[model samples]
Target: MHSLRPCLLFLLLALMISAVPVSAEPPTVMVADYTISPAVLQPGDVGTITAIIRNTATTATVSEKTGLPGSGAFESSKSTDIGVNIESVQLDSKDVEVISGNYKRVGSIGPGQSIPITFLIRAPAKDGIYFPEIWIDVTGGQSVRQPVPVNVNTQIALLKKPALTAIKTVPEAIGPGDEVNARVVLRNDGQSRADQVTVIVNCSSPSITQKTPSTFHAGSLLRGENTSIDMVFLTDKNAPIGINRVCLTISYVNPDGTITSQDEVIGIHVRGRAKIGIASLSTDPVRIRKGDPVSLVIRLENTGTDNANSVKATIDLPFAGNKAAYVGKIEPDNDAPAVFSLQAGSPGTYTYTLTVQYEDDYGVQTREERLQMTVLDGDATGVVIAGLLVFLLCAGAAYWFLTRKKGPGNA
Candidate 1:
C-alpha cells in the first residue's frame, strides 16, 4: 500500500506537469525569401522585387537607415533609414561608369515584418537564359539582399535558307515588239522566323522592265510562309525567242530563329516573235516624167530588250529616191512611227527596201524592210491646156483675116 501511494503520487505529479500552460515563443525574425515579378524579360524590360524581410532582433535598430552596397544607384524602394537605391542597370562588361534612373529609395524594413524593395534591370540581346543580382540595405550598417533570377529571350524573325514554292514565266516567246512576265514565290523551310527578307534576282539575255518590290518584307515569315514577286521582260523584234534563264536568290528564316538563304535558277522559254507588216504610202497616181515627191511611212516597235538609240529610220524607194529621218531613242517596251518623203516622177513600178537601224554596245544593228511602189501612164491632160492657148491665138488671127476680107469686099 505504501508503494502504491508513491506510484500514485508520481502519477499525480505527472498530471500536474501536463496541465501547465505552454507559452508560445515569438517566431524568429529572419528573411530568407524573395520574389521577382515577371520571371522573364528582354532587353529594356523592367522588373520589380517584393522582399519579405524578417528582423530577428527582439529590439528595433535605433537608426532607420538601411541599404545594399554599391554606388550609381538612381532610385530607391521604401526601406529602412538607409533606403535601397538602384542606379541605371547595365552590363558589367560594358565598360560604362554607371547606368542611372533604375531604382528608387524607400523607408526601412521593421522587425518581424516584411519589407518590399523594388528595382529595375535591363536585359541583354540574345536567345539564351539570364538573370539579375540584387541587394537590400538594413540598419546597423548591415544590408540584406536577395538575388532574383529571370529568363530573357527575343521574338524577332531571322532570314535563313529559303525555298521556292511557285515559279511562273509568261509569254514564252514574243515577236520583235512584245513583252514577257515572270513570277516566283519564295517559301521559308527552316525553323527560324524571317522578317525584312529580300530576294535579289538576276536575269540573263533579258532586260527587266518591271520587277516586284525590290525588297520583300517577309513580315515575320514563319516556317512554310510563302512570298511572291514578279518580273517583266520586253522582247525586241530582233530578239531570238528560244530559251532564257534567270537566277533568283532567297534569304529567309523560320520560327526557331534560324537563318538561311539559297540561290536558284528559273528557266523560261522565250517564244513570241515580232512582226512588221507594210503600211501604205501617199500619192498613188503614177507621174511618168520627172522626179516627184513620194511619202513613205513605217512603224518601229521595241520587240526586244535593246533600245533604238538615235534611230535614223528611212524609206529607200528604188528610183524615186530614198528618204530618212532622225527619230529619237525608242525603248523596248514602246513603239514609234517614222515618216519621210522622196521624189520619183519616173514611169516604172519601183520597189525599195527601207531599213531601220540603231546603235548598241556591239555597234549598229539594222532592220531592212521591203515595200512595192509604182508609177502609172500619164495622159494629154498635160498637153490639153497648151492646145487651148493655141486655139485662142488662132481665133484672133481668123478674126483679123475675116475683117480684112470684109473690108476689101465692102471697098
Candidate 2:
C-alpha cells in the first residue's frame, strides 16, 4: 500500500501539467522603413538617420490552450496580450560614426503599433557608399535588424527632393468696383513629402485691396497630395485700367530640414468703364423766326475712364429738316458736338426730346433729355397801313395846286 501511494502522486502531477494553458505564438517586431537626412553627406558631416519600427502582431489578445488528447482534462481557451517591450535600439556603424548613443528601455508597443527611432551619425572621410545597420531588441520576442545605405562625398543621389506646384484660378477680366474671387491650388509633385508649407499673396497696385488675409498655412503634403486656398480682393472705383500682377510666395521645409522658397506671378485684367453725359445744348441763331432755317447743337461729354463709341443723337422737334446727328466717338474727359439743321415750326414755345445713344464697356446705352425753344411770328399788317396813308396825301396835294393857279391868273 505504501509503494502504491507514491506512484499515485506522480500520476496526479502529470495530469495537472497537461491541463495548463500555454502560448501558441510570441509577439514579433520589424523595421518597416528608414530615412537619412542630407542624402548626399560630405566627408565628416553630421546627419540623422531615422527608422520606423512596427509590431507585426495584428490583435491585442490571442486565444491559447493546451491539453492531453482524450484525457477528459481539456482546458478552456485563455486570452493573452500580444504587446512587445522595446529593450534597446542601436545603430551599428560600418563606415560612418554614430554620434548619438543607443536607446534603452524605450517603452512597450501595442499590437500593430509603430515608432520612429533617430540617431545622429557622421560620415567617414571617403567618397563611396556605406551600409549602416540598425538593431532593435524586444523583450521576450525576436530582435529586428535592417541595413540602410548612406552616400558619402559621392555624386550619387540617394534622397529624393520635394517639388511643389501652384495653380491659380481667376477671372479673365474684372472691372472697377468689383469683387475678385480667386483660388490657389498647391500640389506635391515630387517623390518626397513637404512639411510646414506657407503661402503669401500680394497685389502690385495699391488700388487693389485684399478682402481676406494674405497668408495661408498648409500643415503637410504627402507625395501626390494637394490643397487649396481661397482669396478675395476688392478693387477701388477708380482703379487703374490695365493688367495687374499678383505675387505668390511659397515656402516649405524639406525632409532634410532645409527651407525652400518659390515665387510665382498671376495676372488680373482690369477693364475700364465709360460714363457719358450731356455738357450743353444750344442753337446757331440766338432767336428762331417762322419760315427760317435754324441749327441745333448738342454737346456730349464723357466722364469715365474709357471711350464711348458709335455715338448718335436725335431730336423730336416738329420740324421739316434733318433731325438725327452722328458724333462718331468720344474719348474720356472729352466732348463732341452733334448738329441738326431744321426749319422753324410755329410761334410760341415748343417742347422736344433729345435722345443720345452710345456704346461703352457695358454695352449700348440710350439717354433722353427734355428741352424747349421759341419762334417769333412774321410782319405783314404794318406794310398795308403805310400804303393807305401815302395814297391820301398825294390826292390832297393835286387839288390844292389846281385851285391856286385859277384864282391868281384867269380871274
Using lDDT as the measure, the top candidate is: 2
Q: What is the lDDT of residue 24 in candidate 2?
A: 49
Kindly list the per-residue Cα lDDT of model 1 for residues 53-86, writing each as its tens digit: 4555443223222222232223222322222222
How well is each residue in 1-411 modelled by candidate 2, as lDDT tens digits? 998998998887676555444444578889888888988898999999999999888654434333555554554665656788999999997688999958999889988899999999999998889998998898988788788999987866647878999999999888888889988999999889999999988445788878889889998999999999998988887777788788889999999999999998767788876777889888868778787899888898998777788999998999999999999999888999999999997887999898888887768988888889898775657778888778878888888988887985687
Instruction: Give candidate 1 misplaced runs (Cα > 4 Å).
Output: 1-98, 101-105, 108-132, 140-143, 149-275, 297-312, 318-322, 326-338, 345-347, 357-367, 375-411
* TM-score of every candidate: 0.37, 0.49
lDDT of 1 at 404: 88
Which ten residues in a row are the worst by lDDT in model 2?
A: 60-69
Candidate 1 matches the true fold with a TM-score of: 0.37
Per-candidate Cα RMSD to the true structure, in Å, reads 16.1, 17.5
- Model 2 ranges off by over 4 Å: 1-161, 316-318, 346-353, 370-411
